[model samples]
Target chain A: MVTNEQRLACAYLLKVGEPPAPALRSFVSEHGVVAAAEAVRSGEVPDSVATETSARRHIDTAAEDLAAAKSVGARLVTPEDEDWPAWPLLPLTNAAARGLKWASPPLGLWVRGSASLEESLQRAVSVVGARAATSYGEHVAAEMGYGLASRGMTVVSGAAYGIDGAAHKGALNANGRTAAVLACGIDRAYPAGHSTLIDRIAAQGLVLTEYPPGTPPARHRFLVRNRIIAALGAGTVVVEAGQRSGARNTAASAAALGRVLMVVPGPVTSAMSMGCHDLLREGLATSVSSVAEIIESVGLFGEDLVTKPDSAARPTDGLDSEALRVHEALEPRVAHAAERIAEASGVPLSRVRALLPALELTGLAERCESGWRRAKEPV
Target chain B: MVTNEQRLACAYLLKVGEPPAPALRSFVSEHGVVAAAEAVRSGEVPDSVATETSARRHIDTAAEDLAAAKSVGARLVTPEDEDWPAWPLLPLTNAAARGLKWASPPLGLWVRGSASLEESLQRAVSVVGARAATSYGEHVAAEMGYGLASRGMTVVSGAAYGIDGAAHKGALNANGRTAAVLACGIDRAYPAGHSTLIDRIAAQGLVLTEYPPGTPPARHRFLVRNRIIAALGAGTVVVEAGQRSGARNTAASAAALGRVLMVVPGPVTSAMSMGCHDLLREGLATSVSSVAEIIESVGLFGEDLVTKPDSAARPTDGLDSEALRVHEALEPRVAHAAERIAEASGVPLSRVRALLPALELTGLAERCESGWRRAKEPV
Candidate 1:
């Protein structure tokens, strides 16, 4: 657990370090916060990556930063805090975290809101998309947010223009909780038109940020902040993202972490729905279009009920004759390697290697160390 | 094999009998066409429901219909012919055909086109939907038809107004092969405005129908004709069906027959797209938009590649703690009835019956005479 001083010091480091400085941020995690802070204070390079001069700029200003944060009614949450969203915050884990990507999970979060952070995010779903979403996309996002929020699942977003703005407003209008995980400092956030939206969000649910007071928004910050929006929610839904929208980053994070990733399909001709099509086509996400569908993807009720069978979800149902022939070769008890499984299955070896993972992902084949065991589920 | 006399007789029967007359058709298949024609002539009810006098209506006018069909450059194909679309016409099997509901496989098909009935339909895809389709729906259907046609797959439709017209027109415009599976007889099919369009389809590809040369189009005939559209294609894609459109029957036939079924989703606000959404929600079809996606659902390429996995397809991936507990209680080897499985699974009987099919469809379990057995596909 981090001490109050160490927590405050970590807050100071957040202000000085470049946003999404994975290397330095990782160093703090690797070397204890105090030791890492001491290195920065003593003007010693914390690692080969940090220069002595740059390290000095990271000196502790915890006292000042903490006071500034409190002055605005913000509360600091560290990894050790009870309010921290642990499960969805998986990008912080060593193996899951991506390298120098535009998006990364935050070291600590600053929040201000009436709702309890713990409860607000426990069943949260991130509804995000292009800032310039069309009216159709906005309507979908709003409906999704309202529907999900009304079901008691908080809606999380960047609180940007278009889909995000609509989603936040929907949740607020429904008298349901929502959270805005910002790209800038909670105090320094801008695009002034969203001030009312953000303020309502802070009052109704939460306004969260990784940056300390006075940090300016940058191109990379929003990209980096996308990970937080993804990590804070139980699932991430792209309502109407463009092909290159930052919401795609959140989608990637959600997929990598095995979150329920869904995309609301729109008109195939719309530029706004392109990312959604790409995601659906690539099998990165499944298409969902309503609040009930959104719940089916991320809520607890999904687990308790045995829903109707989805043939699309079972790609195994579509296997070619050869692949299906190969799949039938392995025994449930035997852990057959690729060559043996191929021989047993009467399919060529190259095809088995490729077919096994498809089977594995479809929950058909198990990838033991020996490899290629038929999944014991009934065929 | 259908002798020339028997063929002509069947044509006469098609003109008089209610289309899809599954009972009378099955009688012919069972008793042989000559005997069935003899029975119709003797005015002796061939089966229970065939009243003596009403049965006499099913006489052989094969000679007359054949001459009329030839006059319009049409060729009649029967189940006995090599040109027949056989495999997808599963309703011909004794136990498989459902009682008259919407549509069923045809007793015979009339064809008029340059393309071979066998080859053109080998990779055909039915693109169908609402007659009152929106511009968006029509545009999508057209593009999908054109793209699929360009990829060398035959585009099949009823050639109605809106989506179906657009789909056929798109395929015709691309100079690609297309088939119009009409509800009426080939020579009497067109709805005035679509006459030239129908002519072009007949010239370029095929204008086919189960109705004999002079039968008029009727509501029930269209409903029955939808089964042929479903049966004749490798897959069916509903572009913009209304909630009660005949396209829904094709979708249902496609699903029940275990054919690849896809629906192109449009704006949720569009009532035409509602049927698509309902189909998708009910797991009756996967949502698709483009030719590539359409092909992905129907073509063999999907099985060879390790496409990224779809999370929605794996609803079991999100089992709640209680659900997980219930699932884990069942033994892998046991084939337990619903009540027994419930006892073993520690789930309530009602939930067990509900969950079992979902599990069975997911390939996690198998439904047997005794009850549910653990699926052997593998854990």
Candidate 2:
């Protein structure tokens, strides 16, 4: 079933060193791998091209690797494949062109999921932030991941710790789809600690990478990996980051790509949230606190997302009449506790306890450690 | 020496509730007091047509207040006076027009200080914040006030508690000028505790108000007072403020008037600093930390304000070769102790100790509690 010419072209491009892969990708995208091979074979392409010497030698080595790739059941994806993500359709896609110089053009992405890359691309929102995210940041990211995924969007992020892990778990707990894009090969999970999360993502959604099946994650690869996470989503939301955070780099790439960039503002004194504040001040992103705000920014929500059969499970619709009565009892600028709401709603304490859950579930109210107050959009 | 016509115009406008006085100002500017009187007497001016019984009663009552004002040395500053503050030249001056309804325009401002009102206007910078300002806020405000005043700019602020008192004191300690724009009569200082600071500013710079002498500060009057503070300066800097603070109101006025609004950022966790962060995120103001940044924002420099005679006494320009050697020995991006500077300079510790003052005086370096840093600019 394999074409010799395609196999040889793949082999030759993969053998190139360091920058060889990206340059070869550029050559392949502009001219098919067969044409690039002929140019290399005829010595028409420059041999001393910057950082291309390794790429030239990789041709023979790739042939051997291609055999190895086959044995592992991994298939290379080309730009011409039906499964290729159509991100280039976005006007800002040209901004990601900078990623081409560091690594091979992913030799086509290695993907493992039943979901088509095209479909996932159309429905993905990237949720990213610090590996050491605070409990507050974790709560927000989880809520956002669940809220977005419940609306039928695929959550995308690097399979790392903190906010990323929380986002994946939130989606999984909600029985929603989420993809984990890795810096290493599909078979390799960096950090070793997140093996279970990566496995769950592979089982439920997808675990994807540009690297060969066994290639380990490198320091430089993480930076390159961020671009893929950004490109896979229609928008990127940073939950928490510090002044010089890696999340800012992902935001920069998203901004350059002209994707909708959103951020959740945290307490201003937190060093962990300063990057979000900086980005908000720079006008590169909009501040959002709720899933509704994110959905609005991407223009992805309407009757289609909100009016499905699953709408009955939506938090916005789960309120009981008693809860509604209690909410109506409180004035707009006034905060009330559960006791006050119970009294105002003419419900007994026992009944109020039962009603409070319905109010929270309906998103009509929220309970702080102090007491219950009318639920406001996330801030 | 007061003219009857001038007295009458003030009384009538005060009686009529100071209806958007710009047109009246234009009339007064084009014609002398006698001419304005002739127009009013002839019934040519719409404002003079007090046909209703209530309007006529108000005019009579205002005449009594006007008589009382003269006895107390309260003189109105008409818009036409050469001594009038040139606040109208600012971009947001029109936004402050509504504030005119709260008080009568002075025929000419009453004064008690050596500095001319016009000169004060040209150099004014308002420092405002919460009445319950934290020690950190007070410290920052004091530093800003002293620094700006020492550079020959007049500091302006409401004569209230916490930050305001510190700002005025900082200016006074530097033997520099400042203005305390009171919501009440200039004759009485509100917050009784700040009487000493208010008295000092009155003697050294000015204690000004649109309210006639003897009128007590009212809650409503204080709200309107912020506009005058904002209008009188090239910029307004909020040192620290809570979520619903009056300092935020002053910053809003400055922003509406198109004046440079600057805020000092605090630790993101401080509830007191959240207002500043909110303003910064909304692109409503710039964040400033040091006196130099404030001076830069308003286009004032120490060189521009320092007189030749005063420059001689200034600590800058006194650095000896030994001090310069110590400064030069410090590495960029590295914190160097005084001992380290001495070691690196190959100088006796005693000499380095003596030269440290000269180095700081010359602004080539700064001494932090931990160590010294290369001054980004001459301090």
Candidate 3:
């Protein structure tokens, strides 16, 4: 029942590590996925096989993975697939790519969710920042995510702590469609603490990755992952970052992808905001203070293709007792020592120290050299 | 038994003003001040006149002031005079007027000090800043003055308070040659508090003014005055300024004159520092942290034109008891309210309020709506 094109397309997706190769994309565009898949299975066309060493290895691995994918309910969504994300391919599909050099061509993405990837990609925007973000940064990023999502745009961001989690939560709180792009496989969340949030995302939006199922997240992979986030969105906004933060990497990727790069400025005295100031001074990025500016900069207004989602009601689930105890001890603008936090939270010093680690891992607190500081600003 | 040439030259100095007109400059360059004055007085050459109304009035006025000047201790110094500020004419004489457009063509400068104007101009650099300056600003300006002057350059400034007075005092304290370009008449120190400082400058270096001996300082004249400050030096540096401070006006003059413009940066949270920050951001001025940067920026390294005087034991003779009292109360980084200052200094509140007016007039203190702050850093 499978056609020659479908077989070739399947082989192409299997050959590439993640996100299918550009040639495969071209193949899917020119011939249907079924015909491409058929060509790959029959070895009917010489061009169907990958020519480069890396591509060949990727293809061989993908072939093995594709065979195993069906058993795990995993499916390869090619550009020809009705469920494929159409929005991310806008750049690849547009005339802008005619004469540009790509730093890295994304293979077709592996995503899990019932929400349409193609529909979400049409209005997706990535808001990224430092993992150890300040309250000022989180507030700005949250506002941006809420505003953009309310305007019918799908909020896209890495599901990491600090600004990223705030951005995702902001969208979810607004009842807007959102996606979390991860470094690890979609099947396994890396941080372990954000499992509940990730599960929520999977229930409502989508969890996407270039890594195959069960692949653990590596530090190096996050850099490569950032490029996909940049390529997938119309623009990237850096909410807060230090001079050497990873958020700057995302901004650089956005620049390379010919996507708009925006940064939020903060008080100059704050060491954390220096990167944004440096970018503004160097004229590499424009300053964005509000979500309206982001939307205007990305030119996402007045588009009828994207539909706005209804707002989500507040979750009835409250913070656990330990979390509540820790939260109650936090004060704005004050750096609390771990011992002090333990004393104020009314928990044993050993237990409080352990809880502090968990709090940091979950993005509720930041570990400074002197002490642990409350990460989130109180609403 | 003054010769016709001498009378004509004296007349030209009186008629055309202390700084010569552009056309008069050309005429003086071609025929010497004496011949140009004769041509003007005799109406033999109307083509060289810059403005008919001004030239005729100047001719009549100069003929009288020339006679009166001879009665006094002052004497006319024409461009041809060995005592004239020869260094300022180097740009014009060398025909490098492209960047020096902001410089007025000096017909001649009147001299009062024992030192030669020509020799001093060869080593001059202007240090200017906000009249309502902060302590940090004054500190920087003073250091620059002393540092640059000690390195064999004459300190040139407007002699107004906060930074300018500090600069002049810094140069004076270092026993280096210094000049004060006044907006008012040289004989009348408009800000009466600086009478002692002006007198010292008149005795040691020179107190020069474009306006006649009795003209009071006018708001409109300062703009033209700033141009002379920009022109007379190899470069100008703004230490601090508010958004629309007159220091910015001086910087514009320096830029127009093609003089090197340098600015010192401060904490961005301070509103007074923002003007300098804006200039640095706009690339209108280079940010300089140390005195060496100023020296190198103006190319003052190679030539040993002006000799450094013995400044090791220079007396702090000019500061009066009242000025010293106000200066002693100023502390770096702390801005105190008038009541607090009065309490701390053991001065009556009424006396403190009264002293603020005098201090502000002398450029020692700046009045804010909240309180009085030190205009310049205390030495």
Most accurate candidate by lDDT: 1
Error of 3 at A310 (Å): 39
The worst-scoring run of ten residues by lDDT in candidate 3 chain A lies at: A49-58
Per-model DockQ: 0.06, 0.03, 0.01
Tens-place lDDT per residue, model 1, A1-379, is 5588778767866755654556556677788767776666665754432521252253456777788888887878876677777666765463336453434456688888857777777788899999889999998888888888888888999989999999999999899999998877778656679998888898889999987777667555675677778777778899887777688988987787667788887887888887886787667786676777677767567553324333233445577754675566667787877876654443445667788888888787888887768787754
Docking class of 3: incorrect
Q: What's the residue-level lDDT of A43 in candidate 3?
A: 46
lDDT digits (tens) for residues B1-379 of candidate 2 = 4456665665454333222234554465567655654564454665422221112222234456555655544445544556667553344334425543322233344444556788777878899998888887888888889988898888899988988888888889889989988876655769898887877786789877765555566544566678777777788999888877789988987777677898876654456776776677567887665666677776655454312122123332355534555666555567777766654443445666777766667676777777876665533
Which runs of model 1 end up more than 4 angstroms from their true locations? A1-3, A16-58, A80-82, A87-105, A301-379, B1-3, B12-58, B71-73, B80-105, B150-152, B190-200, B213-220, B282-286, B295-297, B300-379
Q: Give lDDT: candidate 1, residue A85.
A: 75
Greater-TM-score candidate between 2 and 3: 2
Error of 3 at B365 (Å): 66
